[model samples]
Target: MTERTAAALRVVNAPWLRPLIFLLLIVVMWDLTIRIFKIPPYQIPAPKDVVITLWQEGPMLLREAWPTTVATIWGFLLSAAFGIPIAMMIAGSRTIESYVYPLLVFSQSIPKIAIAPLFVVWFGFGMLPKVLSAFLLGFFPVVVSAVQGFKSVEPDMMDLARSMEANRWQIFRMVSLPHAMPSIFAGLKVSITLAVVGAVVGEFVGSNYGIGFVLQRSIGNFELPTMFAALVVLALIGVVLFWILDVIERLAIPWHASQRQDVFLAA
Candidate 1:
């Protein structure tokens, strides 16, 4: 490769650099749009304006950002904590699967946004509602993916384990669980994004703090730049959280076929 091509290849290989380039492209496009269209600041503020607004309101945003992040994390953890056991039960037993499968499908069919008001009424404007909302939004993917992963275990491998006289738990731990890692990670990525939405929905219903609360307030006040700044912060937090999980997946499942595929594609 030429020197410039080699440098571009190195950047594409580096995960952090890729995001930095993305952000730069976004800002450049944003600036160009504003300049070309003479877009009013109230409609779509320039990146520099949003940056200055962020600087001015850094402390406020940070304070609000914490509660949203906390709620999102707790809700995500709850989903994983509850989802895995239920998924395991369904995966392991036909009776359990038959009993809960319809209910699970029905739950997902409902419009979660429409139910936000009822959640507020029932839970009464607190962290509980927010966390529960987040959990509800994020939990199904985990359960569904987990079940699929467990079910996807190769019959040949299961037969081999049986022939070796492996116990049920051993079969699960050595065969099913490892095979399920990629699906679990996939579910987690979806869950984290949903978790952020859940938190914001909860805030929209009722909240004194959180990025969602600030965002709502900004919208009401016509503070477009500040609104954009809050959104940028929310996006950054989500990206960071997702990146951390991606790193963990890489470290934990380095030998998985999916990981190998990702490496091959990257190459």
Candidate 2:
């Protein structure tokens, strides 16, 4: 290829630029296909229609989005709070791992959607149920990742710390935690995204105030544009939350290989 063409390809393929370019390409394809086929809006609204609906209903969508956002945050925080400690315990004790690991797997085997109605019945269509649903969905990944992180610390490192007269707490705080942070952050990112789904599931089962509710209302009325707009809002929420976690991870673990590699790539 010519040098100019190769340079253009490199610019387009930059890590941050590529996804945006691909998304734009997808939207263009979507619009073209719809125009060529003369598809009915009811089946799938054009991207422009979805964008217009988002603009017109921005305030209402924002209002509904708040509850889901709140629930997702609460659930994710709770998951991290409880999950990390539990993982630490499991990592510290083979007994605890033996007893609890099977139960965790069993719980995950049961579909959250199937038991969502149970939460609604017990919590009565309130924020609590939604938060609980989010918690359940987001909890597992955090615990699993944390346990792996903690367990991955080399025994020799612990021995060296102990030989230097370090107590258990000091060893954990200085050695295990720093080493485990990257893995823990990985889990947190996954957990946060799942928490969003959990909140929506809770709303789907029984709640009047979330983007999920807006979606349901729009579907009932056959308002495809509004439904698509709700979906767009949901996607934005997940993307924003995940991006926030990624930023935090980079800030918190800049010394780690992953963060260093990201910097190298960006540079």
Specify the highest-lDDT model's number.
2
Q: Write candidate 1's Cα lDDT for 61-90 as tens digits.
A: 988989998888888999889988888899
Candidate 2 lDDT, 181-205, residue by residue in tens: 9889999999999999999999999
* Candidate 2 vs. true structure, TM-score: 0.92
In the predicted model 2, the residue pairs found to clash are none
Estimate the TM-score of every prediction: 0.91, 0.92
